[model samples]
Target chain A: MSNPTAAMLVIGDEILSGRTRDANMYHLAGELTNNGIALSEVRVVSDDRSAIISATRTLSETYTYVFTSGGIGPTHDDITADCIAAAFGIPIDIRDDARAILTKHYADTGLELNAARLRMARIPEGAELIENPVSAAPGFILGNVFVMAGVPSVFQAMVAGVIHQLSGGRPLLSQTMRFMVGEGTIAEPLGALAADFPDLSIGSYPFQKDGVYGTNIVVRGSDGGLIDAAMIRLSNLLPEVTDDPE
Target chain B: MSNPTAAMLVIGDEILSGRTRDANMYHLAGELTNNGIALSEVRVVSDDRSAIISATRTLSETYTYVFTSGGIGPTHDDITADCIAAAFGIPIDIRDDARAILTKHYADTGLELNAARLRMARIPEGAELIENPVSAAPGFILGNVFVMAGVPSVFQAMVAGVIHQLSGGRPLLSQTMRFMVGEGTIAEPLGALAADFPDLSIGSYPFQKDGVYGTNIVVRGSDGGLIDAAMIRLSNLLPEVTDDPE
Candidate 1:
């Protein structure tokens, strides 16, 4: 059977404004890949309510799971929680459970649980809270969508809390063969070989290091034996002096 | 008036597979931001033809300009050229000018222009070629969409070539003020301030360094005077010991 597919939705104007380079998408991509959940697509939208709602709905419907980052803070622009609630047609408010979590954490830290801080207590109806070990604020899973913090550390922690709960397929296997030759020198044969084995994903990444052109051919598939066989064929096609099986 | 809005389409399986962290999106976002083009959205899709074509058409129609990266090489999975043609209903073939450029560059480097290398010459009808100074492979611009290389260096160079050609509005002006106070301590007042200035985008980025909590308040707008005025008000709201205007 095919792997369960997933998608990522990054919400924030900071990302679109180029003020913050996104770290969450890269982190989640690697996590999902290691877990064998195929991340098929990713979309980044601004802090607009309609944009967030539309993208969250589309991704949730298209994939088995959707993970969203950013806009869940206490600031004014942090509207992801509300937008997600609206998208799922559920009412959201400050839940006692969420409030209690924040209250106790703040009490331990000698901080006041003021009105602005209480914004973190707002949760969508009938959603499970994803734990945040680093900070007191919790991420929530509503339906198939997981809403997490935009901050890299908190987002990473939140993913760890729920990653083991999701059903995943076999971990994808990959093997790379590097060559000290230009991509054009091997493109034709490689393309023909790829056409022969349509099930495997064969990718060519070019690199120019120390003024020498080369390409790294990576063969990926669920079956390790199939990937191994494909790598052997690829190695035979390239020149003996240039190919370095890795 | 606001800046011209643009969207980015990243086409590749490597990014989605978690094999590669995308550098093009971050680089292009900064470039577009500096050029006064508002990057509204970014979509990352795999090497699938339908995904590429659909995203290309949608972004082209939705925004003032669309910038696509990846899938323009000579490999088997490099189907961006054909997809762009199909998206716009235009015929694609090896144009003489593009071929000549590649042929001359390869000849200078003592390389033969083989059939695989000639794939780099394919261009959609009526598209303008964007020169690649680092590599001979040319990027193209068809209608509102500018197709660029996936490689970071090459993409940056191509952007430099055409950035001056596009009409840009006033560059977005931003001023940042840092406070050594928690976000909760400032969220209420900050939210009220944001409500007053509907035209400007005010963002708060929180940080925790060396057991000291802080927030960076950034105000962005086309009008420098309005941003400055807002910053002055923000300075008065926060405590004097924590506020460090940057």
Candidate 2:
């Protein structure tokens, strides 16, 4: 079977405001890549309910799995759960299981579980809790949507908790050949080569330094042999191609 | 007057696919912040025309300025310029000004500007070209939307070229006070303080170490005096609060 398609929806105003540079996208992307699940799309929307609902609906319907990050905190802007529940046409309330977790954590820490902090316990109905080892507040999995945290460390922990349960397809293999040639010179042939290798995904990333121009041509595919074959042909087509040493 | 509100729309499938971790969002956010603009929202959509169009329309209408990155390349997936035109109900075609820039660059480099490359030259009618010094393929500004390249370096150059032209309000000045105290202890008082300072945006970011907990409380506002006053109160509230040393 082909790789399971996934997408991410990052919902936050902090991210867009330059107050926070998101690390979760990179972490999740790298994790998904290693797990053989193809992440096909990502939408970083704000805390607006309509925007979140619109994006979530579209992505959930289009991809096999949709992951969301942010807006699940204790603040008033933490409205992702409610938005997701609304998008799926389900009821959202304070779930017993989630509240228990939060209550226990707060009790152990000797802190008051105020209304604001209790906001973290509210989740969609009929959703399975994704445990947060770092913080007691749990994320949820409703149908294809996996609701994770906005904080980098918490998000990473939740991803680890859930990734093992997911079923993935063949891992995507990639080979990069960096050439000290300009993209303008390589575009035509590369396009042709990409067309020839319909199964392989060929990407040309251009970079220039001082006066020297180069392109890192990456060939990606599920089949290792097919990717290797494409790389061989690519090297033959562009003699300047050399393996990138990272 | 207060700082102008802004947002970003990152359009690319590659970014969502985990193939590319976007740098344009960070670059634009920082630039906007420095220019006294508050970036309120960000949406990273795929290459799908509908997704791009809807996101562009929504963000453009909501924010004072909307900057988009990616989907303006030579490849088949590159469709941002056309999408923007469609969103704004404007006609898009190969314009003379864009063609002139591409033609001049290709001519100077002695490279064949094929049909695919020429795709970069097509832009929406009435849009002004944003000069790209690194590559001659210009980004354009139509209404409030400033379309730019997906690549980090090129995106940086495009932002630099156009930042001076944008009308920005007073910059959002921030003062952060770091204290070796848990967020749970600070949340209530901070929330109360934030409510008092209606014009200021206050956020408490928590960090935990081995058996040690800390929070960095940031107070932001256009008025430096107001921010200072709030910070003074914050410092008094939490005696442990101290200035962050770079």
Candidate 3:
């Protein structure tokens, strides 16, 4: 089977404005990789409707699965649910299931469920809810699009709840060999070796410091045998190959 | 001056595959914010040509500036330059000026500048080069698009070199007030306040503990006086408002 492709959409103005440093993308990438799903793309757009809709349609069409973070809160700028509904050409209203969850939580806390707070319960039609362990409010899944919360803690919980339901392919396997030699001297040989092992993906990242040069050669592939074979060949070609802590 | 909107395109399969965690987006966002530029969107696409072209065109048309990170290296997957040229309906070739810079760098290191490595010198016509201090290979600017390297160090250097060239608007100012209360309780009042202060952008981010609820309310605007005025009203209403260390 071919690799399963996934994409992420981060919707927040705080991130773009540098007020908030994003943690969701990195966390999702690591989780998706471990689950054998290849995350193919990520788009971070503001709370604007057109931007979110345009990006969602394009990415969902290109990749097998699309996961969106942020803009699902009960604030004024939180407009992801409505935009997703618009993109899919579906009707949006307060789903009874979601309303029940929020209402129960409000009752437990002895608080009034006002219109502003109830906005969290407003989900699109024909969508299944993804449990939010951090808060009673939940995210929803519509077709291949998984809409989750903006806050990192809640987003993480929703991701855990939903990742098990996804269909995934073989997880990627990688090996790294770092050498103190200059990348210029190693480029041709490494490029030729990479050509020989067409199945394995090779990357040469160069580093310089205090008049010294170094390069980290990373070999990645889904097949373990191919990855190990390429690594052996690489070690023979460049005798200085050493283990990289990273 | 009106706020200049910008977007970022991060191109690399390594990041999507979870082999490499991205640092370029955060760095660029911070630099853009400090320079008074509003970064509205960021997209991370794989090495695929069609995906790159589509994202580039969409973002470039929507924002005042588009900064791309990654896919500008010497390897085979580095196809950002070609994709960008295609997006703009322009032809691409290895220009004399870029070739000159690359040739000089290879000459200084006494390394052979092969066809594959020379791919880095190929840029769109009528583009201005962005200087790379760490490595001699430079990035370039074509109209509103600034193409940069994916490596964290090189990408940062390029952003620093090019930030001064773009015109920026009045710097966005923000004031934060934290309350030790649940977002549900504050939702009604905050929503009304936000509606009243249509000129200011107010966001409430909630956090939960073992049994405690807390939230940070952020007020943003280009006008400092307006933000301050809103903050005063918010503090008076909440009565539990306190300074947020973040």
Candidate 4:
């Protein structure tokens, strides 16, 4: 991969139990792609200790950046921060910096900074806090692992805080060509187009809208010229094709 | 885990690239949970062959059943069947049964049964087909892995076809208790409730609606009575709490 590689580890039983849909992963994927980072893998494990720690260790070691969402809230089930600490064999507790932020925010909101809320201050040893403007509880970055909240709005905000700080390569460029034909009818030429432009990533997505079968041919690469070249070939291969997003 | 453990290996570049969100994982998670199977882990990898093969082998070894979505189409990007075959050391080719299904469907639809379309008929040596009512190109069952389509309708149809054949434990039971207070305000007593009901999985999720902060406490277990008992304690602990889904 030309760009930096990343993996998202989504931690929560709510998702595993099918109670909640995955929003953070989708948001992070778009942000990473826009920042020229290739999201290579994603894993969703329930709020279990061993599973969390094992996934953290593997993803942290494998990818350039590992972003985790969920399990950092102020509840007993919120064990992501502790799992990160355990994954790296680091001691974790309510850090002074995080505790201060929570204390100040809770005081302003008129909510008591009790032990439950105080649990949010538990940060891994020697980690930098990622600012949470939405909620006062901060996400911490331990090594390459960026631990954030599960809530979609909060996760998106934390990403905004973290994304600009990291180094990025050239943003990936993509173009789509729509053909009013099924994937089976267009597969052979699409495969040929993919082979011709070995550098670009070409994907065929089929859709059925209003009883009409169509396929979207998406070509992605950092080089605009190569993507254009691939799309031109696709258009020539199918005369009726349109370079449409719809 | 009292219920059978299952893992979902999502094979596609579309999800990782942020061009498409993960609808299949969410659908499968809910379906698996309702069928008395505990969806333990989910891994989403790109269209790369090695990544697909590695994930397939790992999840197959770890979980009781492995369900993979995407990459079963006729396009060049569709390499899931080949990857699954490679992972299990099986030779893959267009089987007569799958070909017959496709042949009949194409004859009915008046679409050509060309070589590109025939790629969908490639099945592993010993695999049984998972019928696709939405589309004729069938998904297949190879050992513990159930390879299905990426399209939501087709994947759901394939899942419905396969879910009933598997032996399942009792479906997981769950009850929700809502407190008109923040998670921080209710975390301690909720932790105590969780401790008392060791067999139950208790979770606290915070939400903000119309600027009002509240928390939803979800209690889940195989036994309905245990879930009810835990919910009662939660009500006793917080008298303002109501069993609400919203």
Largest DockQ belongs to which candidate? 4
Docking quality band of candidate 2, CAPRI definitions: acceptable
lDDT of each: 0.89, 0.81, 0.83, 0.90
* lDDT (Cα, tens digit) per residue for candidate 2, span A1-246: 688988889887667667778889988887887888988767777667998998899889989999999878775456799999999999988888888998899888776777777878889889999999987889999999999988788999999999988898888778898787656556777888888988877876677676677777878779998988888888888665533210
Show the colliding residue pairs in model 3. Answer: A70-A150
| Ranked by DockQ, top first | 4, 1, 3, 2
List the candidates' TM-scores in order. Answer: 0.97, 0.85, 0.90, 0.97
Residue-level lDDT tens digits of model 1 in B1-246: 778999999998899888898988888888888888899999999999999999999999999999999988888999999999999999999999999998898888777788888999999989999999998899999999999999888888998998899898898878999888888888999999999999999999988787678888999988989998999999987655443211
Fnat, one value per model: 0.72, 0.28, 0.50, 0.83
Residue B133 error, candidate 2, Å: 1.4
Better of 1 and 3 by TM-score: 1
How many clashes (backbone N, Cα, C below 3 Å) per candidate?
0, 0, 1, 0
For candidate 3, what is the recovered fraction of reference interface contacts? 0.50
Candidate 3's displacement at residue A100, Å, is 2.9
Looking at model 1, residue B225 earns an lDDT score of 90
In model 3 chain A, which range of ten residues has the least summed lDDT? Answer: A237-246
Tens digit of lDDT per residue, candidate 4, span B1-246? 478999999988889999998899889889988999999999999999999999999999999999999999999999999999999999999999999999999988877898999999999999999999987999999999999999988998999999998877799888897788888888898898899999989988888787777888999889998888887788888766533221
Q: Please give the C-alpha DockQ score of model 1.
A: 0.59
- The best candidate by lDDT is 4
Model 1, position A31, has a per-residue lDDT of 94
Estimate the Cα RMSD of every predicted model relative to the unseen true structure.
Answer: 2.4, 4.2, 3.4, 2.6
In model 2 chain A, where is the ten-residue run with the lowest total lDDT? A237-246
Report the poorest 10 consecutive residues by lDDT, candidate 2 chain B: B237-246
